[model samples]
Target: MALMITDECINCDVCEPECPNNAISQGAEIYEIDPNKCTECVGHYDEPQCQQVCPVDCIPLNPDRVESKDQLMDKFLKLTAQKS
Candidate 1:
């Protein structure tokens, strides 16, 4: 599943750089996660880096954007292919 930042986010800016997929960004109110770019760190790390670094525990899986580990891996591969 892709992770999302909620209103509880403190805007401390830690999570943005922690995301290996470059999925997190500062929104008008709080940081937002781009689901299309997010892989929940499947191909980059054992865990989601944004969730790991968020101080207020505001990052959580997006229930509406549910995806299997394999799906996340596919997304990661596709993203990398685009960059290459």
Candidate 2:
């Protein structure tokens, strides 16, 4: 599953740089995680970097946004398509 930032988010900006996929970004209301770009760090780390670095534990698994490992891998490939 991909992690999502809730309204509880302080806009602390703590989770932004921690995302390996660059999936987290400031949104109109709060920081938002792009499901298409999120990989939960599958290709880059042992865990989701944003959730790992979030001080408020605002990043949580999104059941509705769930994806299988293969799906996440596909998303990962799309995210790092250039992989330069």
Candidate 3:
């Protein structure tokens, strides 16, 4: 599943840089995660980097964008291909 930044986000700016997919961005109110770009760091790390760095613990799996590990890996491969 993709990750989401809830209203609990403090916007301390730590999570943005930690996202390998660059999915985290400053929204009108709080940081937002683009489900299309979010792979939950499946190909890049053992855990979601943003969630690890977020001080407020606002980052959570997005229920609306749930996916299996294989699906996430597929998304990661697609994103990786696009970069090249």
Candidate 4:
């Protein structure tokens, strides 16, 4: 599953830098995770980095979107496909 930033986010700008996929970005107020680019840190790290660094514990599974390991891998590939 992808991760979602809840309203509880402190806007402290902590989680943004931790995302290995660069999926997290600064939204109007809080950080926002782009589900299309999120792979739960599958190919880059042993675990999700945003979840590791979020101070308020506002990062959680995105209930609206769930994917299997292979599916996540596919997404990861797509995300990095354009990297130069």
Count clashing pairs, candidate 2: 0
Per-residue lDDT over 1-84 for candidate 4, one digit per residue giving the tens place of the 0 to 100 score: 898999999898888888878889999988899998899999898889888987789999999989988899998888888784
**Model 1, residue 40: C-alpha shift (Å):** 0.3
TM-score of 4: 0.93
Quote each prediction's TM-score.
0.97, 0.89, 0.98, 0.93
Q: Give the alpha carbon lDDT tens digit for every residue of 1-84 in model 2.
A: 787888889898888898888888899989999887888998888888888778888889988897998888888887788665
Query: How high a TM-score does candidate 1 get?
Result: 0.97
RMSD of each: 0.5, 1.3, 0.5, 1.0
lDDT digits (tens) for residues 10-73 of candidate 1: 9999988888888988899999999999999998999898888878999989999999999999
Ten contiguous residues with the weakest lDDT in model 3 = 2-11
Clashing pairs in 2: none
Clashes found in each candidate (C-alpha, N, C closer than 3 A): 0, 0, 0, 0
Off by over 4 Å in 2: none
Whose lDDT is greatest here? 3
Please give, for residues 1-84, the per-residue lDDT of candidate 3 as tens digits.
Answer: 998989998889999998889998899998999999999999999999998998889998999998999999999999999999
Deviating ranges (above 4 Å) for candidate 3: none
